[model samples]
Target chain A: MERVPVLKIGDILLVSIQIDMEDQVALQLQEDLAERIVATGVHGVIIDISALDIVDSFVGRTLATIAAVSRVLDAETVVVGMRPAVAITLVELGLSLPGIRTALNVELGIALLGKRDVGDEPADDEDEDDPAAVTTS
Target chain B: MERVPVLKIGDILLVSIQIDMEDQVALQLQEDLAERIVATGVHGVIIDISALDIVDSFVGRTLATIAAVSRVLDAETVVVGMRPAVAITLVELGLSLPGIRTALNVELGIALLGKRDVGDEPADDEDEDDPAAVTTS
Candidate 1:
């Protein structure tokens, strides 16, 4: 399949990805996304990867790099739409995309964008009762 | 520090994170986010994690679960803002965050969401030139 296109949303730019992200492609996408984000002066970014099937170390590293550069651009980033099987595989393979923000879907991610704005506070749902959340590391 | 708050943009939501993301917390967050997405009907989501110390298998799985559930809710998901040191550490530690929608920062993650309405056309860049994109498997 072809690479995903870049689109603009109000003040935030969106980078939609729809293929197995490899090392080089991930790098190119990151560079291009960074440039576009800079051009638009968008502070928030959302990456849709609902179509990706496999992910490797190179792709993982590229993601980390993208986050790093986005910071330089004074923009925040989020990843959305990960597949369950892929998630399992990545975990089984012991692959990690460290320091990356993730959400269940784009909607929630966007809500998180302005979490403090108007949406309901991060309630202490039964799930939110994770010991880790309260523990100090 | 406390778990990052959920950000709310005009039509998007961004959630900043800075934790090692254990399975329990990850799963809880994903489900909660998914529910919120369905309720609010937001546009996109952004997960920012510029301060993660470690990642493990469960964490990856929880992220993947969130991605899949988000899609079912008809919303997109993206993961963003990963650090290089953490990326390498995950790999070395045999840890992975599962393959899902991903970005480097909140800027790009939001951008991905912005373009969803415009129809994210997969536009291959120079990176697609890599042999990896053309996987035999």
Candidate 2:
């Protein structure tokens, strides 16, 4: 049985990975995320990776895949907290995440989930700087 | 009250932004995060910023500040889901996030939350990398 790395933080599932995260783990994680999204019926997800020493292109893509799956399952995904060194390495490696949602921290990610979709013409409580608020700015 | 840029998905917070992220916001966010940790009692934290076109020294420092607050609050922080362009720009601008946690995406970030506090121990299930096993390589 493949193990999907994650933990339950209240009703939300908090996934924090400490390994190198090669292709195998990424695939397994994607599958697990899909299943979990359906079972939990929870639209919120927080992915925390503060322990990795390195992240390659494959890892970045896999993360994006999970985000896509989450959306299909009617769940929202938030990628949070990052180390500066790893961030630099990933960018330098030219890893691009095209259809993924991200937040500066889990708190923000949760905040994102609460936001009214743009189609609804957001209320004044809207933050002008919000990415979703500004249409991919 | 000052409005912080945030992406809310349903009730979940996707991303929180303190753009221009001056020291004051940094301090406030620290307090905010601390309060949140105490309130939610959930130790998982993810910071995402695929929106910020540029991350200056102040922004870098602010992220570090948030990470510190999370630790003090007994919460784990992982910054994830940054674009390669933004990562490179931060790195080139000589802005570095010291002592902050980061991952390529939310899934990895979430995965990091469940890891042991020490060295990289293999995940209980997704450790097999043999050719016969799942292969995306």
Q: Pick the candidate with the highest lDDT.
A: 1
C-alpha DockQ for predicted model 2: 0.02
**Under CAPRI classification, how is model 2 graded?**
incorrect
TM-score of 2: 0.43
Candidate 1 has a DockQ of 0.02
Clashes of 2: 63
Compute fnat per model. 0.00, 0.00
Give the lowest summed-lDDT range of ten residues in model 1 chain B. B1-10
Give per-residue CA lDDT, model 2, range A1-137, as digits (tens). 22334443444565655444766767787777777767766666777654455677777877887888877776667777666787889778886566666666666665666673522453355454756555563
lDDT of 1 by residue, B1-137 (tens): 11323445555666555444655556657766876787777756766554455555565666567667775665677877666886787778766655477787666787777777623543333433456556567
lDDT (C-alpha, whole model) for all candidates: 0.63, 0.62
Model 2, range B4-75, lDDT digits (tens) per residue?
423222222333352445567667666766676677566567776543566777777778877787766666
lDDT of candidate 2 at residue B53, scale 0 to 100:
62
